[model samples]
Target chain A: MSDRQLADWRNHALNLESEVNKVVVGQQTPIRLITTSIFARGHVLLEGDVGVGKTTLLRAFTRGIGGGYQRIEGTIDLMPNDLVYHTYLGEDGKPHVSAGPLLMSGENLSVFFFNEINRARPQVHSLLLRVMAERSLSAFNSEHYFPHMIVFADRNQVEKEETFEIPSAARDRFMMEIPIVVPNDDAIMEALVFDTKFHNVDALVNTVQPDVLQFDQLNAFSNVIQSSVEASDTLKKYALNLWKATKAPLDYGVKVSGVDMNRLVLSGASPRGMSMMLRAARVNAWLNERTAVLPEDIHAVFHSTVAHRLVFSPVYEMRRTEIAREMLQGIVNAVAAP
Target chain B: MKTMIRIFYLLLGLNVAPQTAFAIDSQNLPDVPPGIVTIRTIDPVKLVGYTVGDIIEREVILTIKAPYKLIETSLPITGYEKRYKGQVIGIELKSVSHTKKENKDSATFDIKLAYQIFTNNVVAKNAALGPEYLNLINTKDSKDLVKYRIPNLDIAISPIAIFGQVKIENNMSPLRGPLLLSNVKENKWLKVSIGFLALSLLGLLYILGQRAWLPRMGGTFAKTHRKLRKLPQSPEGLKLGVAAVHESLNTTASMSVFSNNLGIFLAQKPNFSPMATELQQFFSLSRQVYFEPNAAHGLGTNPQQWLQSFVRRCRDCERGLTPETSTQKSGS
Candidate 1:
């Protein structure tokens, strides 16, 4: 691609991030990381308490991109077939095989949302993993494609009953797992609760122009972002070390208070997690107009890129967040300054 | 009448002269030989003596009772010089001393002498020919004995006398009397000094050998020398070293991951291309060793060597890419 075209593609990605920020208040960091992942052609997993605007933020992102969008609420009864099609009889007594939400949206579907993804059975998760990894699904003797698709998943943290935690294989497929918390500031919280527009997800999402870019152009745009972005040796080692630290925190000089490193870490991050982190960091650097990645870029996206990838010891499951924070701090400290 | 009176005065002067002559003659008698020297009458003789004055001089003479040929002779001495004027006075008398008790006969004479008392020079002008004297005394046959010219003088001799018969014997054996006499002449202090010098030379040789061999035996110094030799020489090598350290420090930051992606692109070893063979090898080794179980265990005793080799290859890969061009290449 021409340099101008690459530049325009980068500009468009940054514009999308800004556009999402307008509707999603006080979530610039997550928005940037999510945008980076999108441009890098990787999926994301969002975790938060209810009413954290997780769905709204994803909707804003999809609206800014302007392409076909699908949202599926995960339930224990949700089966692999449900994501593909439904065999039913119509009111006219005619048998029909109608495409499900995942397939009905067609090849142009740029954003696929699976709300409360952990609520879905492992069968559905397995299917989602395949779709996310390959960006294509086979059903009815045909291969359906979603070449430009970026899957945005949210897991409900408050409830665990009947919820099946997404297996590592499925989680690894995601480029990052971002946590959407209740805004800490009273003002932001107040604005979120009292603002009538914020109460209406559809209205807030509709504020941006839909179908702003052609679906076919996104792959080419993402490729340009990847090519135009540069990452230095310092940044690369920092990320890899962080990824390794998650698996073996003690080895990286990270010690969580009250948590025994030897007993608290079941395993470190998989190589796939590291690959995802670099992909996301590269896109973020490109958005920042930096030919080389800076330490700030890596630090800005570390938690989302690495936190969910950690497999904690069973004894430390109740304090995963505390352990993860300690682990991350240890990693940050263990990795030398660039 | 006047001539008769002058002759009477002359006769008186001559009578006084005769009394003066008699007094001079009484004081000029010859010295008698010591009775101990005359009593020791053996075929061969041995004697030991010491110096008694600032300068002692003696003349010895021997008169044989029979027409006998000169036989072997010797002077065995300790801490004494046999000197006449400025020269060593070697044995001149045949069969001067010999042993008779053990038919294996031998002879020895010891004379303990000192330098002139008033001089600062204490070293003897010449060494006594004691060994030659012992050789002559040990010879058995009288026909083979050599005679020595005798000089007579008023000699002061010790009362002790040593005498024996001449016979053949092993002069060098420690059991022999000659060996004891020679050992006395070699001072104990001199023997100790010679021993110390020999020991010091051996110690010096040992230190030199250690210096020459330790490096070849792979000591710590050798290992350090090898490391210094292998250090990078080029600007690219220096850049890579700095880069590796920087990356190692910033391990936790996301920038490192991003940089690695750029490194991968810059290294350009996708599908193991020929130009980036070393990079491909390094990547493959890291993956196998890090990701595959038991790979480290398989490394055996040479883990450091394997690790060092891996690090070096990675450095080589890193150095091949210029920082400015690497960014451009990765972006492309």
Candidate 2:
């Protein structure tokens, strides 16, 4: 891409970042990850406490980029077809069929946010993962396509009963599993509490000018940025070492407190996850107007991009979030930065 | 006011004026002895042999009858200029020594006289102890203080040799050395500095051990791990190990962390972030072992061994030594 086009793309990303920041007070990390994921042509899985503005951030994200926004709340009885098609009775006393939210937006779908995705049955996950993998769905007579879609999903973490977990295969589809944390700063918390506009998520999202980014250019720009951002051989070695550290943390001297090095990792970042990290890092470098991928760029996206893909020992599964944060941190810190 | 001032001036005048005095007639003292008492020079004066700065010596003896106290009035007072008759002798009386000896009939008193002369310009002349008399009084009512005189002892007064002819040395006489003093002393500052140095050494040792700057022997976590490791491979041993790791983490973070609050606890100590995964596993194993013992054995992980390593990591985090650093050191 030309320097001018790169600059324009960076401005659009910054605009969207700020536009989401407008509604989601003190959510800079989630906003940045979402923006990076958007530019990388990858999906994001947001996890946080209820009322942390995960949905609202995605809404503002869609509004900022001027793309079709579709939300589906996952439930125990939700079927795979429920996301693809809906059946209802009309005034004519005859059944009518219509495209579901996923198909309604078709090729213009930019953000298909799945709320409480864990509550959805494994069947729904299989369907969603397939479509997320292919960006298209097979209907009765034709194929419903969403070539520009980025599936943004969130799972309920508070309750565990009656929830069907998104299996590991489905989880690997996401580019990042970013946690939306509550703002700890008292001033931000007070503003979020006392500011009336911040309470109106719909209005806050409406203030954003739609279609600030050309979603159609997102794929091409992602490819160009990934190729243009030069990562040195040393950087590749560093990234490779990081990958090795995750799989067998003991081999690369990755040690987490309260865990054994030899038995800590059941598995590590897969090849797809590693490449996805590179892609995200490239987009990050492009956003920062850097022609080369810096170590800090990789480090910036490392935990979110690569942490979720790590599978810890079964005994440590419950601590995945923490281990993910820490083990990934250990890998990055253990591996030498180029 | 004028009249009062005049009266005050008249009183002041009266107070300042001199007045005439009455006199008392004194008669002859009653003699306790029939004969008069006289003081005579025991030895002739040697005035010619002494020069200026030399003392003139004289021996005087006085005898009186029994029960009569002789009062000698003619003795020269100390610091007074030496005089013979009416002439100043250019000498001063330096000292006087008196002695009394009891005899069977009368008490005899002996006196020694000394004088210092100032001038050496005098030619040979006659000097005297002069005529001295004593008063013998028996009654208090009698007239007293009668005159007594020391008799004159004829001597030739002479001057010293000419000043230039007498040679003088330029330096003073040889002097003695000063008294020896002890050298033994206490150094409070040195002692105090040594004390502080000892304390500083102890502080350095403590810091080195705490930071593991040097190789540390078994500390709290190490000892706990050892204790757990020594326990038999029983369910009780596994449970103990889990509890030990849990306690170590709680102590490190200063809070108890459940499976869910691992993030919260790790947040408190980012240094322990590396151990978050292990802590989670420990918590999960603990839950399995404590709450569902039946399912714990099949969980595949040996809870005891996992706890041992996890506890050690907590110790590492507490020491600010990342496992990678440890592994690097070990690898090296």
Candidate maximizing TM-score: 2
How far off is residue B46 in model 2, in Å?
43
Query: Residue A16 in candidate 1 has what lDDT?
Result: 78
Q: Quote model 1's iRMS.
A: 11.5
Candidate 2 per-residue lDDT over residues B1-332, each given as its tens digit: 99999999998887666442212212233333436455577573334445668776788777765555655443456777756556787677788778888687677889888767665663434454433344555435354444345665554545565434343242111231244565444466778889999989965564334333445434556557667868888887886676666566555555434554567777888978887656656655664555333323333545555555566666666656674332211111
DockQ of each: 0.04, 0.01
Per-prediction TM-score to the true structure, in the order listed = 0.51, 0.53
lDDT of 2 by residue, A169-223 (tens): 7889999999988999999999989989887777888987788888877888888
Instruction: Show where candidate 1 strays beyond 4 Å.
Output: B1-332
Q: Which run of 10 residues does model 1 chain B get worst, by summed lDDT?
A: B323-332
Q: Point out the worst 10-residue segment of candidate 2 chain A by lDDT.
A: A329-338
Candidate with best DockQ = 1
Model 2 alpha-carbon miss at residue A106, Å: 1.5
> Considering every candidate listed, which one attains the maximal lDDT?
2
lDDT (Cα, tens digit) per residue for candidate 1, span A168-188: 667778888888887788988
Please state the Cα-based DockQ of model 1 relative to the true two-chain complex.
0.04
